[model samples]
Target: MSEQRVRGVPAQPSAPDGPTPKRLPAGGQRGGPPWMGAGMPAERSLNFGPTARRLLRRLRPQRLHLGAVIGLAVVSVGLTVIGPKVLGYATDLIFTGVIGQQLPSGTSADDAVAAARAAGNHNFADMLARMDVVPGAGIDFPALGRVLLLALGLYLAASLLMWWQGWLLTGVVQRTVFQLRAEVEEKLNRLPLPYFDRQPRGELLSRVTNDIDNISQSLQQTLSQLLTSLLTVVGVLGMMFWISPLLAVVALVAVPLSVVVTGQIAKRSQRKFIAQWTHTGELNAQIEEAFTGHDLIKVFGRRREVEAAFHAKNEQLFQASFGAQFISGIIMPAMLFIGNLSYVAIAVVGGLRVASGAMSLGDVQAFIQYSRQFTQPLTQVASMANLLQSGVASAERVFAVLDADEQIPDPAAPVRFTDPHGRVEFERVSFRYDPDKPLIEELSLVAEPGHTVAIVGPTGAGKTTLVNLIMRFYELDAGRITLDGVDITELRRDDLRGRIGMVLQDTWLFGGTIRDNIAYGRPDATEEEILAAARATFVDRFVRSLPDGYDTVIDEEGSNVSAGEKQLITIARAFLAEPALLILDEATSSVDTRTEVLLQRAMAALRSERTSFVIAHRLSTIRDADLILMMEHGRIVEQGTHEQLLAAHGPYHRLYQSQFHQAAGGDDPMPVAAASTAG
Candidate 1:
């Protein structure tokens, strides 16, 4: 937007500078195709600690719910831990009852033990002495039944509590993930366009889609299990010491060894998990690129290269995933082996203790059960290390987006343009894509209200870049641009862009009915107004031939429609918007000569009372333009009317001669390069 707007008193509204269309071809411009998933640096991890902490912070909002779940887990584990001990009492009752039935009536327990000793069974006598059995009494069926019933109740209660906690944990975990996904989406909207320019579209989508999903799955599988397993370990350990301290000590011996095994393997698997997710994102980016540019790929005949790239990425993902799973897989069996060793040691020591009258047979039985319970939870935790690592890796990617630099915030009190007169001015404006390479420098110009201004420039001559400055797609490095005598930056971006209508060289039509797509320009537009635009742009003409007419559905890529037809629809969309300022870039390039003539006529009507900035290569179309600008190397080398520029015989004259001279079958010294100006 050069000579774009100025600070001037209200003047009679003439018309916007004419022909606001660009002429650059679709290549080498910073504006790559919408579907091209290229560029952008990947998110790398220095440590999972912060990411893991951040992931847990997502649960902060659900702390109350999580607390309730933890409470239930603790109660459930308490009941579960007490179960084996209660069952051990029941076993003792049965054993003592059977032994008592063999004794004489009314005999003392001491007498039974002495009799066993007299029979030369010293260990058996000692075991019998440790038991609280009456020699004369038969099986105490009532007491045994009560012990069995109590054990069953405790186990049933534990299972019910576990189910309830799992249900609650599911809700909490899902809600946390839902909020995380929403945050990522909100963060994307706040990021500047430059951020998107640097990042691959597919990598971004993976962070939003795949990474979020993996977090949800990982939390759901691990949170409650980890909570319950930890509680079980503590409760079972306490119970083990209560039953037999010697066996408990034996069980404790495996803890450090299990820790060492898990720590060593987990360290190896974490890196693999990170690589696995990174490769997954790269592979996804490639697939999205291949699918979106499928037709282009086929035309270029680089199918083999695309396939090889995909194969390489897919193989990397496979290797990472395999390494992560395989390394973590060893933890479970290693834990189980250690656990079995402890179990055997406990059994042997407890058996000797029971025979020596130091512990009861019932206690020994419970001690063995506690040892198994203790090891089982440790194994579960060790096995879950891979999942935790993978989840944290994904969390780091998502957090990267959330932590990215956002665009400057909109002003609290923004200037409003109730009636923008389309007076755009660039005052000593300077900009550069790279810090070292300057593009436009100290450019000053003004586009008067309601006059057609055509900008003709060579490729990379900062034509589109000028319009981009007006649109604030990139922040200006120096100087300022204004619309309607007000600084563009002073206005809300939405308020500024809402008043301008633009059509690009590359047509974009989302999946929808023809009517809906047209209505997209102005959702509040009336049916009559919509049809009027279609008629003016000549869309209504060909649309009538379709069986569905205005109701005809278009796919995402608009593959069902011809290129010219799609262009017509977009033109109709711009017309329907009824914008105060019009910026058209190669608006008529896709049409046939007949349609181009009609579109030019329709564009003239559209420009009747509006300010327009047109970037044009077809000098014939802009012959009637009020002000013509010839730009080379980002500076306005020449500025005048068509007839005036022809008289001057400068660069614009050479550019003009190269075009019409060839059309008339007359050779000019200078050849007309295909469409001048960068996009």
Candidate 2:
């Protein structure tokens, strides 16, 4: 689908397609292809603690709601304590009733009758025990009913509180993730250019998609179960100690052993989780690379090789994922086993105490319940450790990008150039991408206002690097470049770039109407000015012939446009910018002879009021240039007017003659000497 730009263009109409027109060879256009994802690096982490902490920091803004959710958890667990207590009281009352029915044989009939009557509670005696608790067997049925009703109320309250907690926690999780993703997107725009250079798009996307998903999974697993289990553990422990401290001590014997087991599972899972995310990124990279280069693979008859490469990456991901899950999977069963063992110990030890009259039946029951509560949270914490580690790995990656330095810092004090005279000078400038190898050394030049300077060189002769420096795409290693006698570095980067216009050999047309692409360099330009720029580049005639004219929808990278048409549109864009300095690098190299003539005319027109730098291959294009500079091996070898260079019969003369021979479709050197002597 073609994108529409909201600039100076008519509404575009759709077009049918097989292979739509474009500016260059389909895969080579810049401004980053639409198919490419945001490129950035992934996490390098095997540490869960730091990652979890960072995720928590992301949640700080929503702490108030989270606290309310935890409060609900406590209420839910409070009901758990009351439920079993009610059942125990009811059991004690039933036992008491059975015992009350009989008396000793020596007792008188009147005394026996009185004892039986006393066993049935009077109004005064019933008042001593609270109505909500199960009365002793000496009391009536209404009291037992009240105990059941109270338990029901506690159970209902717990359910209600739990529902509310789930609702709030889910909202918090979603909102927190939304904010995190938004921040990640913002950081993508702010990161330095080199960060993208070092990272793959697929891996970067994995950080945003797969990693963020892991964080959400962690939240879902940890918050709900962990909070409820923790409260249950505390409430059960409190009840246990209340009933019989001795039995409670025996039930906790499994706590230290459970801790050791849980620690081992978590430690193993941490490494596995890290490896898992790494493999996931690798797998994503392979899939992205395969899909993007499918045509190339087919052309080279490498489909089998591509599949094998894909299989290897997929297998690694599967192994890592399986290992992490396996380790994490052990945690729950280990927890259940330890809880069961603790229950058996509590049951055996407490039953003996009860039989010896040292404890009650209710106390033994409560102690076993408490043991489950203790083990449950420990189990939950163990299982969540794996998910938490995955989230941490993702968090580390996100933070790494957020913390990366921005490529261009805005100047504190900025100089702006308006109506520049375009007197550009480079003084003893040197540059290198890596410090160990220099691209250009001690390069110095001066271009006076309104003069065209053409730089000629072999491949890797630092021609493009020199142009990049002029555009300030890369900073120089030493010395400086100035425009109108003002240091370019001191100017705001945006302002510095704004005053200069550049046109490259390969032109990119964005997915938009013809007018929209042309107006990209000046959004507020009037329609008349837009058309005038198109006319200046001689593109207006072709555009007018199209069905929708200026409203024609260009395909991705202007694939629906011809190379010459795309170049014309780019030139139109530069024309709209109306800058004082124009830089054209190999601008007409891809055009046919017919289009080349039109391009030369358009370039000549644009160069009238501007200081222009032309990087040329066809010597005829620059025969009229003010000066020609020849470069080789990062150093300037010659500089003179075209006629003077031809007179010298140096490298320029030989290069000109070689091109003449190629134009004649021959390999002879006669054209070289002939052209040199004729000049």
lDDT tens digits, residues 81-170, model 1?
A: 999999889888887888788788777888888988999999888889888888878789899989999999999999999999999999
Candidate 2 Cα misplacement greater than 4 A, ranges: 1-45, 76-149, 170-175, 353-367, 504-515, 538-568, 588-591, 617-624, 665-679
How does model 1 score by TM-score? Answer: 0.91
lDDT of 2 by residue, 364-481 (tens): 5656666766777787787677776777776766665566665566579888776689989999998765566566789899999999999886666666667667766566779899
What lDDT does candidate 2 reach at residue 395?
A: 73
Q: List the residue pairs that clash in candidate 2.
A: 21-559, 21-560, 21-561, 22-558, 22-559
TM-scores of the candidates are 0.91, 0.79
Error of model 2, residue 387, in angstroms: 0.9
Off by over 4 Å in 1: 1-43, 136-138, 666-679
Residue 570 shift from truth in candidate 1, angstroms: 1.8
